[model samples]
Target: MAIHKLDIGEFDEIDYSLIAIHTSLEDYRLAYFINQKLHVNLNKSKKEIQITVKEGEAHFSRFHYYEMKKDVSWDLIQNKNEVIQQQNENNQSLFSNVNIEVATKVYMLPEFKKVDYFLKIENSENDLNIVKLQNTLNTIDNIATIYLVDTNKIKSKNNLIF
Candidate 1:
């Protein structure tokens, strides 16, 4: 695979509180490649750039990425709260017995204290659900920017620009 280098200028404006990367390859491969190419050491431990690789995706976070994931349980807590909030605000059922769950993993870059998150929504067909997930996740403190990357696009383009 061809390696694409990201420009330093591009990162100047980025806030590392929360970010996401979608890649075609496994999270480990992407993280390893990024570390090698960018000359940065990102590891799962040390809280520098907490890296989590799962199911061909990865996340980077400045804090305990996995701990946060554990804390945000999509199946039981977060989704339930979102559903209740949505229903109360709309005064009607939006999901209507449908399971609304969002699967997300986070990653971070210690050098910049920036984070990247991987999001997968169970009801991806519903645009409203997607928006709600994004909005809810954004509420997490210290999150400055969010980047949604399509792995297929990255594979075809041979680079991750942002």
Candidate 2:
């Protein structure tokens, strides 16, 4: 058989749409509202999106729903996760070996640190009706804002592979 090689750039051409969500509501509650308003059943995924950071391993919650008819996949992912890091104290007079656990916020898309959640749409036949979706999402009383994200501008694109 002749040697066959796949170009690495081919994988980089993966197409998907990302929407940034800003809200104070909890992850489950937001999923509930999206399910109700969008008429899609989004449920918590058993496997979470985990990322290893300087602090530690951070796990982000994800809700998934597949619209078979439309051939589209919907994922509602939490943008932020808290990782606890323990640091040993080096005080001479008092406790020298005390481990201080500090919580640090990790962002899935550090470029958009202010965004609370992300709605990822994949495998759509055509470009999604993003403007209409944003309008519908805005109607939800709890949602503060929703907008399309430019995937090309994201520095930490690898974090979104999950």
Which candidate ranks first by TM-score, i.e. highest?
A: 2
Which tens-of-lDDT digit does each residue in 21-119 have in candidate 2? Answer: 999999999999999999999999999999998888999999999988878999999998999998888888577778999999998888899999999
Runs in model 1 lying further than 4 Å from the true structure: 1-115, 156-162
Write the residue-wise lDDT of candidate 1 on 51-103 in tens digits.
22332334232212222322321110000001111122323576455543454
Residue pairs with backbone overlap in model 2: none
Candidate 1 differs from the real structure by a C-alpha RMSD in angstroms, to one decimal, of 19.9
Alpha-carbon runs more than 4 Å astray in model 2: 1-7
What's the TM-score of each model vs. the native?
Answer: 0.25, 0.91
Q: Worst 10-residue stretch by lDDT in candidate 2?
A: 123-132
Q: Report lDDT (CA) for all predictions.
A: 0.32, 0.91
Clash counts per candidate, in order, are 12, 0
Q: Weakest 10 consecutive residues, lDDT, candidate 1? A: 73-82
